[model samples]
Target: MPQLQAAVKELQEKGIALPDYPDEPGTDAERDARARYDKVKGSAVNPVLREGNSDRRAPASVKNYARNHPQLMGAWTPESKTTVATMGAHDFRSRQKSVVLPADDVLTIKHVAADGTGTVLKDGLKVLQGEVVDGTFMSAAALEAFLAEQVARAKAEDVLFSVHLKATMMKVSDPIIFGHVVRAFFADVYTAYGEQLLAAGLDGTNGIAAVLAGLDGLEDGAAIKAAFDQALADGPRLAMVNSDKGITNLHVPSDVIVDASMPAMIRTSGHIVGTRR
Candidate 1:
């Protein structure tokens, strides 16, 4: 009685139209609609509880149906909860290892020859000649030291130079070692160049001025050498040329050539040296 009452109450609330019992035989469409409405209302009165024992009834019914119809259970078994848990744990551990593994950082240097000579000189020469050096460094300290050395040398030589340093952090497994190697390489190059420059008499004011003038359009080595010699009688005159590509090429005039070439002169003398670490 309660179920019937609830269904009747639900039908009234939903505003479903119901036919009188004395009506003439209903058409097929009318009968179908009435059947659907009755079925829904009937279920609503005693709604199945999916979260309780009532929920288990559906699967049990399905199992019984499969038993009665064995073909439906062919090659089918309920999945084991333990196997699923083990697989989930394995997947979790794999993801953890992936998270713990370190990443790789790559640093590269790109140099373009100013003279289109397919050769790019190192930092010191490039700065003195006012050329471009584009590259990435793994070690910030190494890059900083290299730039500072170049700037200092240019200032000492009375040559105009400028620099811009950009820093960024990248993930790497061994960033410290990578940085140390980079620093060591540049330091060696700087030391080598410094030794070369000291040997040349061109380390002083007069030498730098002569070099600058030579770079400004004075191509005749003898003329520039004479001018430098006259300006600084104390030290011998040295003619230096910095190619548009930033390579410092030094030439000792025949007149100034002693038994041996000056150290500074030899350093800047040939093609720029390009070496990698």
Candidate 2:
């Protein structure tokens, strides 16, 4: 962002007519220019600003009270069906590459296709000495397969299916991933009416709530909604965010964050609320 501003200033000094960048634009053209500039604006402080992992412990008084009046927990048994699903291979964890920079330098991130086509994802990202840079990508095909398997396993085991993701933090990636989950779970619905959904401007990336809301505008909205209802009925029970209101874990990408959901699931004996089986 600083480099872009500097370049703009250099052009202005050469007598080139350019509108001054402002925090708030006063004109239509300036507003348009501001929109364009904002797209390129990003913070390098994201990594540095995040708090590091730390150990959290209960207060001494709380610990003493808990010990004095212990809360009963459900008994664990060999037959317990609790489990977590993950992309065991071809995921970000499996493919991560990292380096400790010995000297300060600028870098570019790019992607090269199997057919030899190249594209730059980011350019002129500057870094300092001793900084650790890591890069990784999850295989989309592997992810789809993993989600499909989990869906099937959920049905076979008669357990509620849910996918917990931290979409708020992983702003760019997790929404796309959540879309994949939506499509996987409703593979039949997508296969049948994918074109219609697209034409209606309903994207799964925004989650089922958005999709359902957009349906009201479609000519065949009722029919499409019926398909969704059938999908829920035929598939395994879904983990509900609110059973009474019919909000499932799949209702929104941001609702069930992994950190929040994981602890809640643990406290509930490996169960999240589910619709009647």
The number of the candidate with the highest TM-score is 2
Off by over 4 Å in 2: 1-47, 50-72, 199-201, 274-277
- By summed lDDT, which 10 consecutive residues of candidate 1 come out lowest? 162-171
lDDT winner: 2
Q: What does candidate 1 score on TM?
A: 0.13
**Model 2 agreement with the true structure over 172-255: per-residue lDDT tens digits:** 889999999998899899888999997776768889999999998888899999999999999988988878888888899999
Candidate 2 achieves a global lDDT of 0.83
Per-residue C-alpha lDDT of model 1 across residues 43-123, encoded as one tens digit per residue: 232333222334334577889987887642123235411110112222223334212113322223335555765543333
State candidate 2's TM-score. 0.77
lDDT (Cα atoms) of all candidates against the true structure: 0.34, 0.83
lDDT for model 1: 0.34
